[model samples]
Every structure is written in structure tokens, then in C-alpha cells.
Target chain A: MSLDFLAGFTIFMLALIMVVSMVPGLLAGLESSGIDYDAVAYRTGVILVEDPGWPVYPPWEMNDEVHKDEIERIGLAVSKDTPNILLSTKVETFFNDSFFTPDDYRNLAIFGDIPYSYHFSLRSLDGVTYNEETGDPLPPGYGYIRRVVKIKEPGVAVINGTTFAPQYTSLSSNQEFIVRLDFGQLLDPSVGAAYRIDPRTEPVNVTITNFGAYLNMTEPSTNATLRTVTFWKKDPTRPIPQFTRIPFAYGTTDSSLYTLTIDGNPYDLTPDTKVFDNDNISLVLKPAATSLFTLDQNSILDIRFNFGDTPSQTNITGIHHYDYNSTNVTLPDLQTGVLEVAVW
Target chain B: MVNDAGQLYTMEGVAAGVIMLLTVYIVISTTSIYTPGDTHIPDMQLEQLGSDVLAMMDTPDTNGTKSALETFVNADDDAGFESMFLSYCNAKASGAADDLHMSANVTYRDGNLIKEHQFLAPDNTWTGRESAVRVTRWVQLDSQPGRTTYAGARAQAVLVEVLLWRA
Candidate 1:
């Protein structure tokens, strides 16, 4: 070999060694970005599926537009004890983009150092109950995580005409039907939140079916006039406990607060519509209206339905206690759903 | 000097070649090329999904009712277990269901021996090469008659192990 060959080889070897040592550091830096994305996605998934947001008693979802800043986190799970089980009310509110801006989701759910564009979607396996999506369209390369969950929906109390006719209908001059909700019993600590009938958070659904059974038989009346529906509350904790009429805008038909349907026609709480014997009545009192009642756990709420006619066209005059009895209220099964979270 | 410089030059050349070869070898081994799949992100996602599905199945819709998992396991209903597990794991938020396969086993203590019984057999999708994740849950069983696989008349705790893989 020539004498110069040794000098050239030595220079090449030293340069190669320097480059090789630096390669590892470069690769590690690149690898971290990929790993961090996946880690963030996993963390977000766990937070949403396994946690019940802060201030769980009143629930974070109950915060109105004024108190929105008080909400620290937003979770869909029913409670911390029941992971992968979501509350339908929380799910509904969380996906309401108008109520929760994209910044809310980033600050509450993602909690990453740098802002990340996120996409969240939830779909029920049955394909009808829930199909909610919020956030931007997905990009090709993004961190993703999917969770299997069950959604707990609010139960509905159905007052079957045939079953309650004998108990409620009577030959009295007054035609009044009352559905009593005992908050003390309904919010018992023993019952899990997943199954508890919480009037404060869930909608109070009362449906009266088979109206023909309660019509006046002697007068051969084909229909009865539903004069007004009023809400009354009694606080047993108070020194003098008695049912008093709750002040509300009964004439204003606000679908956001409550929905009163008679014979399949939507009306306000003061629906004076004449119901045919074969018709049905459904009253859905949303949580927004319930929160306005200034009620506590000990308060007893009564939904009074007054039917007015000259000779009492209907004889539905008894208080139906809305308790845990399966006969009165039917709790639907937990619906299966899938939730996906992606971060980029 | 009897041309001893040639021997020294050959020695230098060999040393340089060895040094170059060693440097290349160290660099190649130290700097690993990690593909996206090598990160095991899919495995982590699959495992988490499997565990969540099992936990949700074990929770009853109502307070006093038996969970779907307990009922199926107690009755030795393998078919029901397989279908429910697949339905939960394969469900996607895009309205399109994914294709996932699973097999399960029940591990129980009989006397002093730990025994494993196959609860659900793998379907035709099993090729033995797919990457799979294992998730387990503990189930309490009341004293009952001896069944096909598990034989016990006393209350005991058993572990339900499931192997999940994307098809």
C-alpha cells in the first residue's frame, strides 16, 4: 500500500465513528414524538371511560353557561366505580358542541402541554340510540384508542290505563291525577348511580297510556279535557311541611325545559287540549326545569294533572307513587356502545 | 534496515480495516430502525379494549340482577360468551364493525392443583401467527353441581382468561 493510503483510511474511519454515534440521538428524538402521541391517546381514553368528572355529587354536567368555568373535567362514565359504563345524560351534554367549545375539550380532557387537534366519536352497536361526534375530521396518521362501553339511560314511568284505572278512577266530582316523586326514596344511597332514578339529573318521563279506560262510562263521553299540569313540592325538612304550587311559566312552551304531548300533539304544561278516549299523554320534564325547583334530597315533587269538565268526563283522581317498583316504572336495559378518541 | 517497513504497513492496513468494520457494526446494532408497528401500540390498544369489555360485561345493568358474564360462565354457555365478547370487541364508532377473534379459558383451583379449562375454542381465523393479547378477570362462583369442565360443590374464585386478536 502507498504511504498516503494509510492517512486517507484513518480520516474515513474517524468520520464514520462520529456519524454513527450521533445517529442514535437523532433516532431517539424522532421515536419519542410517535410514542408520546399514543400515550396521550391512551390516557384520554381512560380518563373519559373510567372516571366520573369532578364535583360528582351535583355532577359537572349540571353546570350552566354561567358556571361553566367551575367544571374542571368532563367525563362520560357513570361513576368511578363503574368503568366503561357511561351515563347517557353526561354523554348527551358532552357532545353538545354549542355548550362545550373545542377549547373546553382540550383543556378538560386532553390536558397535554401543547395543543392537539382531537376527534371523538361514539356509536351504539344497535345503531339507533346514540351517534355523536365532535371535533375535526381525522387525518391519516394520528394516535387512536377505542373503548367498549355500556350507556345507562333514564327509566320511564308508564301509567297503564288498564292497570291503574281501578286504583285511580272513581266516581268523584274532581278529576285530578297526580304522579308523586319522593326524592328521599329515589335518591337512596344504597342504589348505585347507574340504576338510581335521579330526578335532579335525568329527565322525568311520565306516560299515560290507554286513556280510554279512564273515561266516564255513564255519560258516554268520548273525550276529557286536560285543563292544566302543575308542579307542587313539599320539603319535609322544613318546620311546616306542606305541598305548595311551584311557580313556573306554565303558559310558555319551551321545549328545552319540558315537553307536554296530548294525543300526540305537543303543548306546554298548560295544555287544555281535549284528549280522545283512545289517545295518550306524555310529559317529559327535563333536568333544566328540575334544577329550577330549588329542591333537595328530602323534597317531594308532585306532578298534578287537572282534568276539567262540567260533569267530570274522567275519573283519574289518585296519586301514583313513582318508586322503584318495576310495575310502575320500566327501567330499560343498558345499551352497548363504542367510544373512540384520536389525537394528532 | 531489511525492508521491515512493508510488515509495519501491512499491520497498519489490517488495523484500519478492523477499526472500520467494528465502527460500522456498532452503529448498525445501536441505531435501531423502529417501524410504526414495532412500537406495540396496536397490542396496547387491543389489550385495553379487551379488559374494558370484560369489565363492562361483568357489571349488571341493575343492582340486584346477575351480570351477563356470571350467568354465561355459570351455565357453561360457551357460545353465548364467544358471541358477546366478539360483539363488544369488534364494535367500532364508525358504524362499521371490526373483525376480531377471541378464545377463552377458565382457571380454577381444584384441591391443591391449579387447572385450566378451555371455555371457548378458537374459530377458523386462528392461524397461530397473529399477534394476540391476553386479558383476565376474576369471577366468584357459588356452590353448584359439577359441570362438564369444572367440578366443584363449594364456592370458589375462578379466573377467566381471554385471548383477543384482530383478524
Candidate 2:
């Protein structure tokens, strides 16, 4: 064994040991890829649950197909301050596959470097209100995250004729029932978005039931004709504050914008539907139509229902203020729900 | 062959071999290849879920209304708190509700001593063997003399700590 040969063998052994030690470091980088998937899923979950998304004033959910590129992110939460509290409208818009393509979801919600596949689902505890999902099927191994949330549903103003007949019904020949929405009071800065009623973001539901009490007792008629439903707006900030009729496509029967159902029969805003004594009238004004009206925070919106039956068959005529009064509007409690996200 | 000079080289070779073998053994033993399941993903999920449930419970549904968490703590409604917490935690998107268990403690500063009161007792499923995640929320309470757990006469802030686990 020459000294030169011995030293060469020792150097070879040292090189082999160093290479073996470096093997673990190489494997570590590979193992991190799996963990990275979980990290992406977790980030997507946080974005959907905690964030209110970009372009918040005119919420990202409100963007239509043509303007979809303007949306920077997709989130379900009602507002920035209220995390884990989702808005029903935002949820509906996010899960609408027709409106948003798979690419849109990947770009907005599940932002990842490798174009990772994703699955998102949300179900209300009650099992009826919300059951929505999007994306591809799950594989055997996937990064997953689940968040418990509360769904904030819009309130409905229910005016039972039996309760309001005595106060509103009059002998006046002109019968006009008005439901006033004071945006100043509704969009007050003091009120949080979780509880605030913004017509530009949510639907306005007005239901009047038990019409027998409102029917004129002197007449032998069993029903009254609902001629037209018109919208009027007044801005208090104006030099002379006075309500002017808002011009809209009242003749077009667009259920997407607004829905008017009388006696379980769907009708347009201009429907001259006859309302029976035992029937109910429901008007749902969606946010899409409200946005078309160009209303500001200080604007006052009035939905007037004109009963133009000659020789007036009904006496239902008065302004129904749709304010925060519990008796006028019934705001539902925040419903508990679970939202899950999976990435692979 | 009385060549003592080669002995030093022989000794050096043996020393290098020993060092190399030890390094190989230590690297092989310590460098554990972790499977996806064994990673901290499950812990992160559970911790996030627990934190979300606590946060949602603390938020009020309406602007002026009292949050469910504050109401339960102010009234010392242990049963109500337990049921609410479990309901929120166990709710699922599909299939049967998840099997989740929870135990809670309210920590408040009473004068100089930080007191901890058992707000919710663990159910029978709790065997002390489950991997539980702890989540906490700060709750501000107004002076309520009638409360049994918080006998404080002045307004104070308290921490609601909950240990959550899947049964």
C-alpha cells in the first residue's frame, strides 16, 4: 500500500460520503411540491372566505360577462370587515358556471403557478338554502381546507293586509300603494354592510298577502285590477327635492331583472293582473335593475303600485316605509354553513 | 517488511472509512421521507377550521345585536355555548354532519390573578388521546353581577379558548 494510493482511496471515500449526504437535500425539494399544493389550497380558502374581493364598491360579483376581465378576485364574504360571513348574492354569482368560465375561477380564486385543479363547495346547515359547487372531481390525494361560515340572506318586507288594512285602507277613489326605500337611511355609514340593505347589491322583496281585508266592502266585486308598477326616485341633495318617474323597460318581461307574481301567476311590471280576495302579490326587484337606475346613497326610491280599476274595487293606498323597523321588514338571522376547497 | 512509514497511510485510510460510514448511517437514519398524509396539512386544516368557527360565532348577525359568543358568556350559558360551538364546527357541505368535539375555557383577569373557568365540559367522546387544536377569541363583557362564572363588577375583556378535535 503506497502512501499515494492510500490518499487517493481516502479522497474517493470522502467524495462518496458528501454525495450521499446531499441526496436527502435533493429529496427535500421534491417533497415540498406536495406541501405546496396544500399551501395553495389554504390560500384559496382564505381568499374566498376572508376577503371581500377587489372592486368592492361595485362588487366583483356584479360584473357581467363582457366586463369580467375587470374583476381582480372572486370572494364570497359580504364585506372586508366581516370575514366568514358570505353574501347570498355573491355566492350565487360565484357558482354560476354559465357566467364564469373555469379559467376565470382559476385566475381569480385558485391562483397557482402550475395551474392546479380545484373544487369548491358550500352547503347551509339547514340543507335547503345553499348547496353550490364548482370545478373538477377530486382525486385520491389533494390539498383540502374547510371553513365554517354564516350566509347573510336578504330581508323581505311582508305587509299582511289583515294587519295594515285598517291603517292604510281608505275610501279615496284613487288607490296607489307606495313602498318607499330611503337609501339615505338604509346606506347609512353607521350601519355595517353585514346588516345594511343596499339595493345596488341585493334584491328588494315586497310581499302583500291576504288581500280580502283590503278589498272594498261596499262593492260586490271579488278582485281588483293592478294596472301598473312604476319606480320614482328623489335625491335630497338636489336643489329642489321632488320624485321623478324613472324611465325603464316596463313592458319587457325580464324575470332576471325583476319578478312580479300575482296569485301565483308570474307577471311583468306592467301586468294588469287581477288580484283576488284570497290572493297575494309578490314583487322582487333584483340588483341588476336597481343598478340601471343610477341611484346614489342619498337617493330615495319609491315603488308605487297603482290600482287603476275604475269605480275603485279596493282601498289599499298608503306609503309602506321599508325601513329597519322589525314590523315592516323581517330580517332573517345569519344562517350557518360550511365551505370546502380542494386542490390537486 | 518492516516498513513503518506505510502504517501512517493505513491508519489514515481506516480513519476516513470510519468517518464516511458514520456519516452515511446518520444521514440515512435522520433523513426521514415524509408521506403527504404525515405532513402538517391536517393540523393546519383543523386549526383553521377551529379559528373560523370561533370568529364567526363572535361576529353579530345584525349591527346592534349582541354576538352569540358574547351573549353566551355574559349569561354563563354553558349548554347553549357548547351546542352552538359544536353545531358550527360539525356542519358539513354534504353527507352526515362531521363528528367534532370541543371543550372551552374562559380566561379573565380578576384583579391580579388571571382566572380560568371551565365554560364548556368535554363530552364522553373526549378520551384525552385525540389531537386537538386550540383556538381563542377576545370577548368584551359589560358589567353583569348576576353571571355565575364572571363575577366581575366592571367591564372587562376575556379570552375564550376552545380545544377542538374530530371524534
Candidate 3:
């Protein structure tokens, strides 16, 4: 009886010791946490490529530091209808790491319990610009995705005085030159958002070159005194259809709103200065100021160049239609690029 | 005294042995649930790569031109589509190409019926047991006269599905 008890006890003790030693193995298998990295990367890639993100009205790209929380997602696509077509504005804003921290990217772009390291890179096929955001050097194993995409650039209206000088120049004392943007015509539904020239989202550029040709040869002075550049809006739906001056902080030279360059010198849009012959008058109306005007789809916004000199030193008059006419606005061809996302 | 001691020691040993065996069984069953053994990781990666390649092929290099995918689908050029897709899928940033195979089909709605046109048949390497992933893209094509696959006189959206697998 004593011998049988000893054998049974010894067997139980050996089995217990073996089970205790295998506990670490069981924990090792339980902690094999490498299965979900690729799935998370694929999800992140889909979010960035196919979706246009939330808060579409104000645009996620326009959110500043204070309004960063308002951006629910970060997507590179121009709109939902168009996939793999990125907007230059959104691309610029997304890659600006200084504005967004790693936590913001993890929460907004890549949502997961574990904080995964990421690397994103984009380069134009034509070799224009190469952008990269990286957490660390990539390890041997990682989840990666590469997508080819097209970027739609904003259009520019380049008006040369030599081309339109005779057509625009008039004997009228009002030397005001107007660049009219008919929002109804521009935001037409027939034109897809991918190809639309939306002044609400993109900058409106109107450049007047060869100032000599538009100058008043009859005046003794070869220079024109530009009094002020003002913005005007008109609502056709209103009972009275007439142009009304838009109230703005005209005295402030805010580059964020609009930029005026007379002969390559940056100045306020309302600069009262003398512009010489052969000088170029370039005006860029940024999207920030356009949003403030509170204009609707059918509204007409006019950028008027007022030359207030005695006897009118410049003969730049008449309303120039900023339309899709190849002569008026030069729209660049869409550029192709490749974007890669890697997660580890 | 001998009978009492003998029986108690035997019962205690049996109870302890049974408890150790139960703990091992529970630990193994719980641990197996946490480790899924990497079955889905490769599938996810392959699916993403295939989808991305197809999407990129459909995007035109420049505005106002036909994309490579559109051109291939319009002309019913399976060879062109297959070669282009494989090249894109195999391309790497390090300039080395990977080994991947693909087969594709285009699904479109025809009247009240759905029709599928085989775009590319799998090659010799394809077997019945290989783990394959399916990826799809929407291709908008203008109506082509006398084309049975498209089956419409107006512009239509067709889903291009590709099955990708690695050897």
C-alpha cells in the first residue's frame, strides 16, 4: 500500500511540473499579434484613396489648427464620383505633417487599438514633385500598397494686353477692367467635379501682361495709376439685378485672401500706385476670400481693376469673361503620379 | 490508522493529477483561439495590390484621354489587358518585379439579366487549390454598336473583376 501511494504521488508531481513549464509556450502563442497589420493597412489605403472624406461643405483641407477637430477624415480624392483623382489642394494639406501629428493620423486616417508605424509617399510620374511622410526606416516585413493617380490642377486665365488690347481699350473715362466669373456657368452639373473649375475651392488667377499695349498712347505718361482693386457680386434671383460692392477689409493686405502683384512687386489689392508700361498685373483670388463672400451657385463675382488717374492713363475697360475659352483661361492637363502607403 | 492514511493519500494523488490535466487542456484551447496562424494576412495584401493595380490601370495618364482599361475593354482586347495588369502588379519601388498571376472577367447588366464576359483565362500555373483573391473596379464605357457584352446603346458602368494569386 505504501509503494502504490508513492508511485501515484510521483506521477502527479511530474505531470504538474510539465504543465507549469508549458505555460510560457501557451502565452507565446496567445501573444502572436502579427495577423492584423495588413488588414489595417488596406483599410487605411482605401480610406485615403476612394473616399472624399467628411465635412465636404467647408472642406477638410481648409480646417486650420483651431478647427482641426472638425475634420472627421482625411481623404485625397477630389469627390465621391471620382476615385484615384486627387485635388492638388487636398494633397498639399494632407502631407503637411507640421499641422497634423502622428496621433491625428492614427485616429483620423488609421484607426486601430495598437499605434502602428506608417510611411506615405507620393511622386509625380513627370518628376514634378516628390513628397514623403515617414515614421521610421521600414523593416523587413510590412504591409504596403501602391496606387497610380491623376491630379487635377486649377486653371489660370492669362490675359495678354497685346491680344485683347484693341478689343478691351475704349475711349470711356472709366478705366476699370473687370474679370467676370459666372458661377452658374462654371459650376454646371454637366461638367464633372473632377474637371470643374470651382472658384469656391480653387484660386482664381487673372494675369494681365504687356501693359504697354493697354496703356494710353495718347497720354503723355507711359504709366497708369491703379487706384484700387475691388470685388463686386450680383444675384440674378434678386428683384433688382445690379452689381453691388462686396464689403471687405480692403485696407488690409492679406495674402490669404488675395494677392496683387504690379510689375512683380507684391502689394495690397487696393494699392494706389503707378504701374509702368511692360509691367504685368497679376491678381490671384484665393478660396478663403471667396468663401467669405457668401455667394450662391448662380451669383456672379466680379474682380474689378480700377485705375483712378486724371484723364485715365490706362485704357483697360470692358468686362472680360473668364470662361473655358482656350484663349481666356489655360487649363493644365491632369498630371499622373504614384502614391504608396506602408504600415508596420 | 493504516487504512485511513492509505486511502487518503491515494485519493489526493488522483485528484491532483486530474486537476493538472484539466488546466493543460483549457490553456491549449484558449491559446489556439488567439493565434489564427496567418491564414488571412496574405489574402488581404494580395487583394489590395490587385485592386490598386486595376484602379490605376483605369485612370488615364492625362485628362481628356481614354484610360488603358477603357481601351482594352472597348476593343475586347484580353491580351492587352492581361499583360498590362501583370506588369503593374509585379512592379516594385525597388525596380524588381514580383511573381504574380491573374485572371479577369467583366460583369455588366443586360436588360433584366446579369452577364459576365471572361476577359482573361488563367494560365498553366493556376490550380484548383491555390489561394486566390478577387478585386473589382467600375469601368464606364460608352455604348458600342453590335457589342453583345455591353448590351446597351447608352453609357454603362461595368464591374471589372480580377482574380489574383501567387505561386
Candidate 4:
């Protein structure tokens, strides 16, 4: 009987030892290691603000749904040179929850062994909500960081009737209004990246107002038929500089790339459309289209607006240089914003 | 004899139980309960926020104009600098501002000695014991004319140190 009791007792002792050995492992969840949450938050802030992020060429922000997997990191700053100055496109992409999954944010942004829940928010000083959140509801005790940032808004070239009326009527009815973007002057190294007009990333806006003033009023009707708008690129670095029409998928209307609005109605650049005078002609060329153009810093991008009618509709002509002429283009001042990141 | 043997077994069991209990007690006690000192997370967070606000202020909004930080530091406008810094730190996405207090000092090298000018004084509620974080920025000044705090009037780089804490 004693021997049997001893065997049972030994078994119980062994079992107890085993349970004791596993206690630390079980308690591991209860007591986390000295990994600082705030340190993780600070690191994340630095990643988003200072670094330009992975795949600098093409930029991670350019990745679409299909190419989403290729993007390793999401950074908002325009470039490493301009810290705390975020690019609007990058900001949009980073906050787009539909494009990026939670796992993607975990792996790409708050990289840690243990997956962390995060809340990121950016509010512009102009009271615009650029982005609100990227994750679940923030818990009580979470790693938090707040950064003050300035957002570099895209510049618009406004060619009103007052500024270009004389030049428009100067040439006879070939009917082409050329708005030239000198990339060399726009991308001058002396100009800081925060304020530089980089066509590769920023949308090019050309808004012509008071169209009636430029119309062929000499013709009985004040309305003019806009034939087709075409993009032409010329590389000044080449020995022979000549403008060549850019080959684009003009057949399909990609509003993401470029949008042409005549009096507020969207229309395809190709084919014939009637442009009424006393209306607005706004053309916004998105960065995606600019990237597809394959133009470099020395290349001059011409946005030619062609008007066609049997007797020639409009007398608008000559190239309008979209430079720092404040009267021609209105560059909005950089607005301040606050970006907060919380991780747990 | 059987009774004696039963008594010995019971005593042995009691001894074993005591040994097991002691082992667990020692193990649990020795397992270090991590103190906050090991991870200065709060301090780190505060430092980063302060630094970011200062750095952002130093950055020019456009290519041509002077930075807000330079203008504030050059003019030695304590109230202006304090208000700006607080606003930048306090403004939140929720449209509600945070409650953060700060004191600032400008440090510049004056010949052989390093001089510190009291840029901003703490408010009346400030106590010496609050856990505060220090953040600094380097501001280059064209000249120190009409300022008796620092020695040389020539162009010099000054360090703007700000001590920030939560109220």
C-alpha cells in the first residue's frame, strides 16, 4: 500500500513541477516586456515625417489596388529634404483604408513583433479634415505622438481674360491657346522642395475665366466650338528642339489622369465640343498623366487648347508662360496642420 | 509498524508541500516587476512632440520668407513664442486643444562663456517637481545688436531649449 501511495505521490509531484515550469510562459501575456509604447510612437512619427519611404522612384503613393502589395512604406512628407511638409497625394493614399488593409499597415507602418492597433489623424489649419483615422478606436492607454506639419498645396495657373485678352487676339484663327510649363524653371534646385511646383507629383491646373472676352465676338454667335485639346512635349536638352504630340490613351476617358470641364461640365479632350463664351474652361491634369508623359526637368509641357469652326471660332493664340508671375498663377500659401499618431 | 510508516509518509508529504510553496514564493518574488524607469515612454513621447513643434516652426512656409521660429527668436518675443508653441502643441484633430505648459531659454556662445537668456518664464502654477521633457532647436541669428545677454554681435548659432510638461 505504501509503495503504491509513493508512486502516486511522485506522479503528482512531477505534474506540479511541470505546471510550475509553464507558469512564466502563461504569465508572459499578462506582463509584457519593457517595450516602450511611446518609443514605438516616436519611431513611427519619424518614419512618416522624415523618411521619403521605400520605392522613391514612382513613389509608394502611386501604387494602385493591384500594385498595393509592392508598397513597403507610406510616408506623407514631400521628400526627405522637406521634413514636416506633407504631400497631399501621399496624405490621401496613407489614410485610404480601402486601398490598404490593417495587416498592410501593421507590416508597413508600425512594425513590431506584436501587432499594434493605431490611430492616425491629420487636421489642416484651414479646418479641413485631410484624414481622420487608420485603425480601430483608440483605447485608454496607448502610445501617442503629435506633430505639427505644413501641407504644400498644388498651384493653379489662372489665365483670366483680362491678363491674356490682348495676346489672345494677336494671332489669326489657327485657334490654339498654348499654356507652357517650363519644367526647368519650375524645378530649379534653388527653389525649396516644399514650395516647388513638381508636375510629377502635383496636378497642373489651368483655369481660363471670362471666355466670352476671348471668343470670336466678331462672329455673330458668342459660342465657339472647341475642337480637341492635345498635349505636346519638347526636350530643350536635345540638339533639335521640336514639339511632338504625346501619345496617350485618348480614346478612354480617365478622369483620374486628366479632366476637362467646359462651363463646369466634364468632357473628353478628343472629338468636337461647343465651348460657350462667358463660361469657365478648367483643365486639371493629374500627376498620373504627367508621369505617363515621360517628360523630364528640361522638357517643356504644352497644353494646347484647339478651337475649330468653319470660319474659325476664337482668335486665342501664342504661348502663355505659367511661371511665378503671381498675376498669372495663384500659389496658395502653405497651411499648417497637426498630425497625431497613437499606437497600442 | 504500519502506523509508524503511515506517520512517516504524512510527515514527508507535509515537508514536500512546504518545499513546493517556498519555491513558488521565491520564484514569483524574484521575477522583476518592471518599473517605469526601465521604459521612459512618456518622457520619450513628450520629447518627440516638443522637438517636432520646434522643428516645424523653424521651417519656412514658402521658399522666400523667414521661418516663424527665426522671427520669434530674433525679436526675443517671449509671449509670441509661448503662444505659438502652445497653440501648435495643443491644437488637436478633435478641435479641442490640449493643456501643455512650457518654459524656454536661448543658449548662445559668448566668446569663452556660454550665455543663456530666459526667453519664457513658467506660469505661477509651476512647481519644481513636475516630470518635464527638454527639447531644443538650433537657430542662426544674423547679429545680436542691442542685446546685452550675449557677447559677440556677429552672426552666431543659438540653441533654443524648451522645457515642456503637462499641467
**DockQ of all candidates, in order?**
0.34, 0.38, 0.30, 0.39
Q: Is candidate 1 or candidate 3 better by DockQ?
A: 1
Interface RMSD of 4: 5.1
Over A1-344, each residue of candidate 1 has an lDDT whose tens digit, in order, gives: 46646655665666567667766775664566667778898999999999988778678888878999999988888889878889898999899999999889999999999999999999988877999999999987688899999999988989989888998888874899999999999999898878888888788999999998899988889999999999999999999999999999999998878999988889988888899977889999988889899899999999999999998888888898888998888888888889999998
Chain B TM-score in candidate 2, rounded to 2 decimals? 0.77
Q: What is the lDDT of residue A68 in candidate 3?
A: 92
Ranking by DockQ: 4, 2, 1, 3
Q: Write the per-residue lDDT of candidate 3 for residues A1-344, one digit (tens) a residue.
A: 77768877887798788888888877666544444566677788778877788777777887778989999998888898888888888888788889889888888888878888987777665445545454556886677767666688889998888799998998774898999999999988877777788888788999999888888877756899888899999999999999999999988888878889998899986789988887889999988889999989999999999998887787789888887676888887666666777787
- lDDT of residue B134 for candidate 2: 92
Candidate 2 residue lDDT tens string, A100-122? 88888899998887788888899
**Which regions in candidate 4 have their CA more than 4 angstroms from the true location?**
A1-39, A167-173, A217-221, A310-313, B1-34, B144-153
lDDT of 4 at B127: 98
- The residue-by-residue lDDT of candidate 1 on B50-145, one tens digit each, is 998999889887768989998898888999998888888898888467899999999999888999889999889989999999999988878876
Stretches of candidate 3 exceeding 4 Å from the true structure:
A1-32, A139-148, A161-167, A171-173, A217-223, A274-278, A309-313, B1-37, B59-66, B75-132, B136-167
Candidate 3: tens digits of C-alpha lDDT, residues B87-140 = 777755443467999899999888899999888999999986889999998989
Q: How big is the RMSD of model 3?
A: 5.4
lDDT of each: 0.87, 0.86, 0.81, 0.81
lDDT of 2 at A192: 82
Local error of candidate 3 at residue B127 (angstroms): 8.6
DockQ-wise, the better of 1 and 4 is 4
Q: Specify the CAPRI tier of model 2.
A: acceptable
Quote the lDDT for B54 in model 3. Answer: 82
